[model samples]
Target chain A: MAGVRAAVVGTGLIGGSLLLRLRDAGLDVTGWDPDPVARGHVRRWGVACPDAVEAAVTGRDAVFLCGPLPTLSGMLARVAAATPEHCVLTDVGSTKAEVAATATASGLGHRFVPGHPMAGADRAGPAAADPGLLVGAAWVLCPGPNGLASFRRLAALLIEVFEARVVPMSAPEHDAAAALSSHVPHLLAGALAGAVQRSTLRDAVLSLAAGSFTDGTRVAGGPPQRTANMLLGNRDRVLSGLASVRAMLDELADALRAADAGTLTDRLAEGRAARATLGERRFDTHQREFPAPADHAGELDYLRALGAAGGHLTGCRTAGGAVTYTGQLPHTPDPA
Target chain B: MAGVRAAVVGTGLIGGSLLLRLRDAGLDVTGWDPDPVARGHVRRWGVACPDAVEAAVTGRDAVFLCGPLPTLSGMLARVAAATPEHCVLTDVGSTKAEVAATATASGLGHRFVPGHPMAGADRAGPAAADPGLLVGAAWVLCPGPNGLASFRRLAALLIEVFEARVVPMSAPEHDAAAALSSHVPHLLAGALAGAVQRSTLRDAVLSLAAGSFTDGTRVAGGPPQRTANMLLGNRDRVLSGLASVRAMLDELADALRAADAGTLTDRLAEGRAARATLGERRFDTHQREFPAPADHAGELDYLRALGAAGGHLTGCRTAGGAVTYTGQLPHTPDPA
Candidate 1:
């Protein structure tokens, strides 16, 4: 672990932040960015900045592809080809299904773990990068059948070095959950912003906007192109989530129009109860250990189940060839 | 304005904060709450705490009713009966139209100004109040016929003492704009929070709840009963705004389902553009003076027009019986 070498390709906000975190953790980290400006910023930060993604990832124990959704597949393929056989691969893309599929189709699934770090800033680019971005963030890692060992390696770095909670789930599960938690929120924010802008009382609406309006539309202020890519990349799940949200809204509207106070109050109370289950920004961890599965499918199923139940892998160890995975679960059994 | 007497009825968060601000401004202030705990808290702050609303508002130059929506009408009626003739009565209810109607029905419309301060906290009650809550917050005042002088007096207190921007509009106009800016946002937040809670991946979703999820659902964390009351009070406008937002969301879903990147990107960009129009929290003021209207209708129309244009009344002056109203307008003509 002390001699572990890592590389981060595409040194924008997320990647640059990861690169800095890894370097601060005393890992030998090399970084690369297609944008010369990003690469120059990394070099100025006193980190190794290789001119090529291939050069940066060569001989690294772990390689992270931190490109936009549209570029992830190509970047993953190139990184997969250049890195050593023992290298564990992951990406910081918001959506995971497509990337995981691309890796599996290319026969790189065994070593590739599609990941998404649930953290960001309003600003983008390397200049806005800070190592603190990953601290205590939930980093979801979708591990395939043959990628159990790779998941363990990558998750250990995320947990121990970056102080990130490593959530293990399948790519499809990850995508569906993300649609509800992230993508749809972005779309909703945008829609709210757009609706207010188009209102005849647009100026007045903006003037009267309070905490609710500000918080509800804050995500719409993010880079539009990136948000679009995320919603589009996870199109099916986002569509389903959007439809569900729309129906919920329509129901509330009907209740309001009908002056059904009982129904409206119940709906709002349900929401308040649900929001209370979010608990807090950070949670107290209760660790648990499980014997690793005997095969690939067994490993995948076990990890997915644990994550579905809100458990996160901390690390794993092998004693006499019998692997054991250690994870942390919240003390509260049901958030509800 | 020195020695001006002010009374705040139902000293909860908004009322308590106002009572503190009024006292700090060197006004003779009295506060009362039906709840003994709240009245006790106000007394602890070295302010007069009256047992009855009548006694609290007696001889007051300005009286503020800061109770829940259901209690507002009764409180307003009681205060109207108890206060002196020169007293300018106002309420901090979220909805203006209904209360304004109630005041008109009771023949108290001339002295009653329906006002809503666009500031709040997660916690409620007098103990949670902070004098700074009203600082630089938008305080919407729906002024009607015969209330021009009353509006000017109350607005001067808000502008000069509390540092609140006084937005003048009609009751219906205020409600409609608020639906888009505040009420609808609250509904949307609750809906989002509820949807995630009911998701199959509820735990995973909560674990991955980042800034967007947190911000999008923050308002859902407020008191459910109060939020429900606000939404129900402004039911018609909220219905309209919710319908419009539903259509926008459904359209985005259709675009995502069809993989219509062009339409999706365009929609997101529009939202980003719209959100950008929110601009800075505080805007630079450009003061303008207008000759006071000769009639009640003229005054109401002028004030509503100014508020609709995102301008706020600052103060007014009279010389040789010629009244002139001075207001502040943002330097930027169009936020968009």
Candidate 2:
């Protein structure tokens, strides 16, 4: 990819990582963040910090929006107002349909390309910035009619810099897929974790809990507004995804209630197979995984106490999932 | 915890990991594994190798039978033949109610204790064993009679050695919990992973899949017969759990069908909270969660090729509730 000047909005996990990656590849990049904390975060990552989004995107060849759903439109409006006419815009939000719709309705459609880079970690902020964050990961690009072939070219360029795979789809397909791949599962995990309380022996529950619980609930720890926007934003597609999930679940429930052993086995078998295939490609950490300093018994204890207070359970000893301990904490449980 | 003499039967992941833990704490321990491969695996972990199950538990004070359900009765028969009058035989099977029934039917009721250790990896066998495997994990002890006091003492010893917590529940309750905690989730994951073929954009789906897909399906990668036993042994409870899951899915589907943002948001919110709690606890892993091994890729490839050849999806990649890619090499996709 030729040298690309990019402006990263949000300056947190995705954006910060992108900035690092862009610079690591010798690309000239600047960052924009409204929050001092976030700006500081990007500054720490050695990216050129600009005072405002308008200033940042006006001169950059491409503007990358990388914050939660709510912040995207506001920032886009700023970009629309001052961005050079030739500038291309994209985002790394979880949902695309809604974000795309909002952009069109806001009349910033021409300059914006509806896109989502599918890569990140549970912990957010520039401190967690990884140049390889999107390495070999999928970057979903949903281009509007006015998004332009040049925008498409920009998407491919972003893919190379991030070392990511680009999958093209409509805003709605992206929405349903995200719901299928991310949203509904997160919801299921949140509800499952939430239903557990002091009365449920949650500590004991978590101790015995395995990867299934964590995977089912990974999205629960995300920013509520961000997750809500994804849900409320792509309402139709998400709902559609949920409906398919519901049909699958209802059939399972009936089979169980009726004591249909064959059907029950079949269902369990089905889930087993789903998880198996999905987990089929495990990455070799050619590099070490947890850079987490030696185990902190005290911090672990503190987190445990907090969880207990919420009728939630926590663990700090084994490192399987949730390698990071920070963030909003998981609130939702998908019963399935 | 007082010093204890323990014999772990069917020494695989749980049994071997347990035995190593026992010996590390200076307890007298021995292992009995009829499977030569399993025996070698257990012996490598520093556990005493007993000639047979009867020999292992005969003079030993406590014995833990940790294998699939089909072998439980045979194991019990061996225990009955050579058990000391006060010996307590416990199990580490996923399901408890039926296993307890098996003990009763086998005429070893009082001397038999039904157990399900909540702590374990989706991976199995001694190759998967580690001394700290059960540390900070939970063990469910469902004792049957007074002779169980001795075993309870041994269990307490285990609790201290492994640094794990304990939960008390009847066999049926244990099964019900396992159904919720383990079985149903496995089934659901299998079904979900089953829908997506490995060869279908393998690079893109996997590169973008992230933690959720991997974690959700972790259980599906378990041993097939072991998985079969979990489903059948706790068939009733598992069936009920499936019903509940199906019900939840149905509700989600309904909301989607009606395009009810309000209800969908509410449901999503509930799920979010549940997942957050689980995420907070960090679920099963307290140490390292290796991304799914590359072997999963092979399984996917294999299934992809198999599906191509047979015009159907293959369930080889999944088991338990997680996916596995370790054991076999996948065939190329094109079949002549």
Candidate 3:
């Protein structure tokens, strides 16, 4: 790990934090950002700030395209062409299906492992970056056809360097899950805020606002352009998520109007049960090993199944032609 | 206020807190709870624990009927019958319309002022009560046709004793506002939780849950029965709020499918604008006086207007046949 060369393109909060963490982990890391101000911050932190993306990726064993959604596909294409054939590629974008398709179209499918790290702060830029951001966070990796080996390499590095839990799934699986868990929640918050703003009792409503309103609308405080990018970038999945939620709201409205206490209580109880599981998450480790190289397809299937079951890889190592993966089994609470 | 006699019935979190605050303000306060364990807690706090509701409310200047939604009307009837004619009665209930109607039907409209103190915690019962809970909270009082004088007396006492901001509005107004700010948010949280629970990728979704998901669904963690009671009690308003929110979701989904960036950005910006107002609230005092007891209806209209405009009463007093009220005008940010 000490001699492994890793390049980070896009030195914003996520990228800068990864650069710092990779450096601290003793990897030979070089970072590149188009913004001169961001590049200056990298140099100030004593990390190499390559003036060009090509200079950063050349001769590196791994390259991370850590840019915003709109810039990701271009970064992927440029970085993939510049890096050596053996180099593994990954990106820290919120959505995956579109970029994964771009990589496949460019014949870089075998080297590119699509990813999203579930960590951030309200503030942006390298100055606000903290290396501690990635610790114990869930980092999702979507490994496509012929990408299992690359996923293994990147997942292993992330696990060892940042102590991040690696979750493996397909690109579409990641997008749909994110739509339900993250994208739809953002839209819901925005809708709630918009409704309150248009109310005739806006002032009084805001005045009487308590914990519920504040917590529910907290995500709507982010920049509209950024939120719009993430939402629109994952349009199809978000649309489906919105449809599901609207149906839920319709059922709830009916229950309330009909005074169907049974239906209402059942729905609320289900939600409470689900929410209870959130607080009960404990790191109960479970380990599994697969004979790598020889059984690449089998290993990929196993990792996907583990991720689908809510398990995450804590450690991955290739020794004696075998990949020993350490992970935690999902905690299943009793039925509501 | 030293010799004022105040009693709290059906002692729980809200009721117990009120009792402690009243006693702290040098009032002779008595409390009554059906549960002996709660009575023991009141005694431990060195406050009087009357054995029955009749004993608690007898000869009191003001009596607060603090209980659950289902038990409130019954407590109001029992407390009103036992208390002296001059005693001003109020109840700590989340929804006001139904209870206010009950008071009117019981022919205690003049003395009964419906109230809801916008402060609480996840924990319940006397042992979990904190006198500091009422500090800096918005305490809404709905003054019916003949209830202005009673509203003033309670508002003044609350302001002086607990430093609570007093918001005056009609029962319908309070219910409608609460539906948008509190009840509907609870339902949304529940719906989001339910959606995640029902997803095939529930484990992966839960694994990737971040700040937005956690904050948006925090309120769904409350007791389902209590949440159900609130949503059902304010059925019509909750239904209307749900309809409005569902419509917003539909519009958002349409924009996402059609790639209508302008509409999407505008909607998100509107939400961000509305959410921005939540943090910009600051108290700037304004004073007004009305010749009370001479033009009671005029004073009521003024108070209602103040509440509608997001103003809150900080102080109230009667001198020389005039009621002087100190309030804070709403803080309005420049339009987004």
Best by DockQ: 1
List-wise, what DockQ does each model earn? 0.74, 0.14, 0.71
Best by TM-score: 1
Candidate models: Cα lDDT each: 0.84, 0.60, 0.86
In angstroms, the error of model 1 at A39 is 2.3
The TM-score of the first chain in every model comes to: 0.93, 0.76, 0.92
Q: How do the residues A1-336 of candidate 1 rate in per-residue lDDT, one tens digit apiece?
A: 569999999888899999998898888999999998888999999998988888888999998888888998888889888999999999999999888988999999889999999999767899889999989898999988778878877887788887777899889988898998999899899889888867788889988989999889999988878888999898888888877776677667777788887888778777777677776534455443434544676667778987888778766665565566676765555677
TM-score sort, best first = 1, 3, 2
**A161-244 per-residue lDDT for model 2 (tens digits):** 665544555666566566666666655554454443212434334434555555555665665445555666666655655556
Clash statistics: count for each candidate: 0, 80, 0
Off by over 4 Å in 3: A1-6, A16-30, A36-51, A59-61, A121-130, A292-294, A319-321, A332-336, B1-5, B16-29, B35-48, B122-130, B291-295, B317-323, B333-336
* DockQ order of candidates, top first: 1, 3, 2
Please report, as a residue range, the 10-residue window in candidate 2 chain A with the lowest summed lDDT: A309-318
Which 10 residues in a row give candidate 3 chain A its minimum summed lDDT?
A: A291-300
Query: Which of 2 and 3 is the better model by DockQ?
Result: 3
Q: Give the lowest summed-lDDT range of ten residues in model 3 chain B.
A: B245-254
Clashing pairs in 1: none
For model 1, the superposed segments whose C-alpha errors exceed 4 Å read: A280-302, A314-326, A333-336, B280-284, B290-302, B314-326, B333-336
